[model samples]
Target: MYVLDTNIISELIRPRPNGGVVQWVDTQPLSSLYTTAVTKAEIYYGLHILPMGKQRGDLEQALHQFFSAGLQNRILEFNSTSAMEFAMIASYRRKAGIPISNADAQIAAICSQHGFQLVTRNVSDFAECGIEVMNPFTE
Candidate 1:
């Protein structure tokens, strides 16, 4: 299975017509894709700028369309174990001097723990953390 990084989900929610990554995802088999809690948080963070009156409604509609229909059953939810793994990855990267966002670290840890190929645009960052990455735009 493939775990989608934050940007990939962002593109799906607020689509970029030229986003090759999103297009590539469409070619994958059913149940082959997945999203982590980190991704969901990132998407929600992006949408936080929306007016308060519309935020909830907009987010609900977007999520329903983006996940229910777009990703189907591949939307993986994070559990307590996943959080522990994320903390581990964060510490490892911190000691290694490879600075990265907490969300990215969490996603990477989830992918590592679950043995899922990470679909991301930032390959170098994840590579330094030793997580396998696939750049759909270039692939």
Candidate 2:
């Protein structure tokens, strides 16, 4: 299984998404693809911060449709198990003097809890999290 990071998800909504990412996604089975609630929130927050206009409206519509149609029940939630995993990951990173954002930690927790590899453009951000990561933009 694979959990799509926010950047991977965001690329899909781009006017001209990266060809490498698109091709990589296309080669995977839809059943193997998953996303976290954190990713959903990130996408929504991004759209929310944009000024209201035709561009925003169009992007919103696209995003809504993408979530409603493509993702459906594949969105993972960060529950108790994930929370515990988050605590461990955060503590370890902190002690080692490696900084990770809360959002990235949460996503890493979900991936760790579920034994899923992460698909992201920012592979290095997740390197120390001890979860498998694949950079679709590169491979």
Candidate 3:
């Protein structure tokens, strides 16, 4: 299984997303992709900050569809296993002088706990966290 990061979902909802990512996603079986609840909240958080307008309305609808697709497939939730992974990853980053936000840590934790490869554009950010990451936006 694969974990769809927040940036990946954001790219998909944008007016013009990375063609490589779009193509890569299209070629993959929908069942192979998954997103954490954190990603969904991130999308909604972005939409919430947008000024009221047609653009926001459109984005809201797009987010609804994006979430619906994942819901049908699976939306991984944070659990005990996730916490164990998070503690290890967060502590390691701290000891290594690497700074990662709580949200990013949560995403990484879920991926580690489930052994899901994370698909994202920010490849370097998730590196060294003991989670597999893929950047489909690359050539």
Candidate models: Cα lDDT each? 0.76, 0.94, 0.88
Tens digit per residue, CA lDDT, model 2, 27-73: 99998999999999999999999999999999999999888888889
Q: Which stretch of 10 consecutive residues in model 3 shows the poorest summed lDDT?
A: 64-73
What TM-score number comes out for model 1? 0.80
Query: For every model shown, what is its TM-score relative to the native structure?
Result: 0.80, 0.98, 0.95
Q: Could you tell which candidate, 1 or 2, scores higher by TM-score?
A: 2
Q: Kindly list the per-residue Cα lDDT of model 1 for residues 50-80, writing each as its tens digit.
A: 7777656776688768767867766666677
Candidate 2: list runs displaced more than 4 Å. Answer: none
C-alpha lDDT (0 to 100) for residue 131 of candidate 2:
99
What tens-digit string does per-residue lDDT give for candidate 3 at 55-102?
999988888887886456588998888998989998899899998888
